[model samples]
Target: MGSNDSEYFSDEEEAWVMYKDRSEWADITPLPQNDGPNPVVRIAYSDTFTDVYDYFRAVVAKGELSERALQLTEDALHMNTANYTVWQYRRKCLAHLGSDLEKELVFCREMIELNPKNYQVWHHRRVIVEWNGHADKELRLTEIIFSQDAKNYHAWEHRQWVLRTYRLYDGELEYVNRLLEEDVRNNSAWNQRYFVIVQTTGYTQDVIKQEVEYTKKAIEKVVNNESPWSYLRGVLQHSEKGLHSVEGLESWCMALHEAGNNSPFLMAFLIDLAEDTMECHIEEREEKLAKVLEWCESLATEHDKIRREFWRYMARHISHKYSV
Candidate 1:
């Protein structure tokens, strides 16, 4: 059987076939669902790299854009999905060939499974969704991709575009909450939460007030994690209140600092709060701001040596703490 198999596969496509229990979707298309040593591509074709490459060149040479041109491009992409030119040409062919875009979405999703970070595949997938106008399906597919890699910029960008284009911001905050519950250190999740909040509610004080309570819970969860602290600063910075204007904010930082956290971010946040509360040239609250900044400088310099330069830079640049 092995010797006879050589007759069907091209030199580049030669591989062993191991039968396994296939899914109901197996007939849908040939994209491998499992990975193993020497995993062969599921797209069984006798087309060789040389043959596909030659045909692609011939089509481009003739400027012939048709459905027949897709076969050679697909074969080439099967070997190297990163080829931008091939993907661009394929898009042109796809549009002119009257090809089935629904099937193309399936193919693109399968390719994404092989390498989620492949730019061309994602670009092509985005183009198809935009052209076909399946906002709901695009949202669902992007959510699945985000579940696989929460911090994937491309996936997040696509999700944002889908939500904005379709006005689908209803459940995004809840989705972000789920992500945060899974890992509080997920900065991307925190960022997404902020995005959703802004998209739905804008920067109104009520929204900021609600977000502040939510953010404080996260900040106090792990005083050392910088992501939530950054999120807290970002949302609050856009609010009507200054950073330090939040009730008991200073004492909370003091409590966290005294909890033996040695967290540069908490200290840094407190330092910003103190500086923001001061008038630049009025000298009011200068004593309080100076003391807070000096304390943060000393703490960061001693315990967080990694960011000591940053603390030093803050001290050198900030004049709010100094008396006028």
Candidate 2:
């Protein structure tokens, strides 16, 4: 049998028998040629998505081709939902067609139903929601995704973009409140809340309270020292609120203390934090550095190298007059 053997043998009746257990197999029983110009060559090919997608694209690029290209792409997706290239080309084709926008959105929604874990599909769904929905439709779409996966960064980022791009923060404070009530320690959600709160309402004492509480909650989520160190860096980066407060700093120090203070992770965080600080504030940081160094002293003898290095660095900083 030739390579076209399966194609010739597969009729609707036989297709079910050959492909009942293999849905990806296409019944390519040849139809009568339409007797049109540049008639398609009847080349034997596999039923794989890649082969069909390539053939569809080739025919689509031909001048004023028929709707068969779109049909072929759809067929390819039906055969293999995981074919990202097929989805990509379909997106491009839909984007260029003014009338097919709704159809495109429906197709993307189908893609999401097929594979909810696909970040790319979620992204495409976002685009469709933005185009199809009215004033608050995008937010509704975002809510749908978050409900399915509260930790989805793609969905979170998309929500942020929708709000910021549309300046839809009249409800932002409400949004932050909802997140706090729901997950309490979702860092991505917290970060978005921080951005929305600061930009929409400006930093205030209330903002400080929330961030402090968030930091505490974030610290609790960590079973190791690294998370607290990571959380502290986030606080330091966005200190519009009083995240660098004495209480917050102490909490951070306590986290390191519990991790043996001089664990390589603690030392690395401190060193990195110091590097990010300005030389002019080297003296100003000495007090906190001393506090950290004191905490480091409790480390076991085996951890001496990290403990000694940080202690020496703090001592040298205390001796300097560099002021903030």
* Best candidate (score: TM-score): 1
Note the clash tally of each candidate: 0, 0
lDDT of 2 by residue, 1-324 (tens): 223234433554344332223343343332322447675675433544334544554544542223544555666565555556656666665555543666666676666545556676766666665666643555776677677877777667777777877888887767766875676556566677667866776555565556556655654554344544455555555554222432445446446556654454555555444433333355556565554444445332345554676556654564363332
Q: Pick the candidate with the highest lDDT.
A: 1
Task: For each candidate in the order shown, give its overall lDDT on alpha carbons.
Answer: 0.72, 0.55
Off by over 4 Å in 1: 1-47, 280-286, 319-321
TM-score of 2: 0.57
Model 1 per-residue lDDT tens digits across residues 172-282:
888889889899999888888878877888867777777778887987787789898888888778856667546787787778778776677777776776677664434
Clashing pairs in 1: none
Clashes of 1: 0
